[model samples]
Target: MVIKVERVLHMVGGGGETSYATNSRLQEKAIYRTKPILEIAVAEMYRTLLPEKMVVVDLGCSSGPNTFLVVSEVLGIVGDLCRRLEQKPPEIQFFLNDLPGNDFNNVFRSLERYEKKMEEENGGLLVPHYVVGVPGSFYGRLFPCNTVHFFHSSYCLTWLSQVPQGLGSEQGVPLNKGNFCIAENSPPQVVKAYQEQHRRDFSTFLKSRYVELSIGGGMVSTFLGIKSKHPANDELNYLYGLVAEALNAMVSQGIISENKVGTFNLPIYGASMQEVKSVIGVEGSFDVEKAESIWDPFDDSDNVLSGKNVASTLQAVMEPLISHHFGDAILHELFSLLADIITARHLLKDKCNYTVLNSNSLSSCHRRHGH
Candidate 1:
């Protein structure tokens, strides 16, 4: 299918304003919380592969603000370790990657700021050799074989393109028409189809990573996921149902037309830990280094439910999906209503929490993959 690059870029730009602050804060949290996990991954890479220079890539790098935050933290840790060991620091090359539609302007601006900060603080001693933007899906090889040492991606893979087939109005059915709900609320076929799509997307993701990472290289990624034994109540399908319920309510109330509601689909999928490991194993290139599952309650501090935070979270989660399903015109109104509903229903006010899986906890797998 032909990708609507311009349309996607416009969508990103529209949402870019609010995301600046929210993404910054979220990146800080990710950097701090995930530091130990990253350090372990990097240490494994150094011990096993022993690359003279560490080439790190951030897939789905977006506007590069988060990329800068993560890379800076990783480099700082690496620098400290080198000092303690009395070994010279490894040369670092950071490649910031994303789709062609990502907002390059914002990314470049952020990079300039990062460069200025480095010049002032480090006197350019710790400069990355290359800070380049690569445009394409990370589900394919973006670099030559054996070129990368480490990879990091956060909160990006769960999104496929705007027109994920089998969803929306073209099918003449509600998005959740057949989803299993409350044990027996929906049809089994629907659940199978939903799951099958994620399996395919995830499989594609693994294959892509396999081609890009060197034999001994590793990747650390985190995504919204669930810890459930039953396949039906997995976080991905459950959240899909929740968003579908909200959309269906809006359709029934005439807040949005049935056709418009029909056009939209949730752009995210929350995989279970087992599901992630299985997919990675099937893809066959990397061993699980560390796997951790934790439920981070989304309190008011997360800003997902409060004044400015509410708008930012809505934009981050809804913009891509809305632009893909509905046109840009409706996004503002739709998200506004969504935020209102979330607030009025006191959903965010109560504690919006979800589970996340980290890769640092898989030490043995790291050793195995490093070999």
Candidate 2:
């Protein structure tokens, strides 16, 4: 059975050992690394439109310190721009969007502290901004037409709307056995199925967002990607391939069914920059302004790789879906096995999983055609 990602997927909740909030240093580093790009996008959009109220949305904003990091980045850029221009700052409407299962309650509880911090940082003159939570899948419409002025999403678009179909036979037999995501052994048909699913999902996402974004508006997005179009044996595939190995280990001990391992696949695709540009071109709503692959923030050559740290981070992101499919019993042992495998293999020593950064400006033709 194909899992409904919106319903099943979420970061590990609460401030616990495996919670995303605690283990998200990698993503936090990514946000900071991409800050300059975000600054440009926000400043350029504000300068061109000069709207009285600037509306910004952070899609797939899982609850964490990074949740408000994007908001603060936008506020600081726009607020400073207004000062330089000697114009009053525009009212900022910020939306933090994620799937319904995200730890929004934790995010909500942290707001008071964030606001107090903001007030103190602003010297008691808080920037004119309103924050709200928007829970929904970004693969479909989430806002009214022509409302949003800017959008920022980081480490999110890699998630597919649903698991790719055709991994199984007409009689309900598994095809891509002994693996979860794309791997060196994945059959050509399995790979094509995943590629087609990503194309469909990305196209739908762009069409929906284009309808919601106002004329001349823009977006900055950063997502995990592969340096090469061939996904097999790529950095991302190897990263997830380790997890598949752990599962197969369990299957050997009869801790989990082999069929279960055969049927499950991660709903994520590490698209190359070429694939991203191709989708944007075919979607026809936005013009790609800039696109490039950035260095992997997780790679730190100065220190030896810590298997526990890597396992915790992946657990924070994958635990919910893993538990839903494989039962809670497998979580602790599963991650423990994964940790041992990482240390034994020393897989991350020189590997780099590239991140794709894109800044897209809504096309004028979209406005002219009233699309």
Provide the RMSD of all predictions against the true structure, rounded to 1 decimal: 4.2, 2.2
Candidate number of the best lDDT: 2
Tens-digit lDDT track for model 2 on 323-359?
Answer: 9899899999999999888767754455435455555
Supply the TM-score for candidate 2. Answer: 0.94
Whole-model lDDT per candidate = 0.61, 0.83
Task: Quote each prediction's TM-score.
Answer: 0.82, 0.94
Candidate 1 lDDT (Cα, 0 to 1): 0.61
Worst 10 residues of 1 by lDDT: 178-187
What is candidate 1's lDDT per residue for 268-328, written digit by digit as tens? 4566788788877776655675788767644346433453454455466456645566557
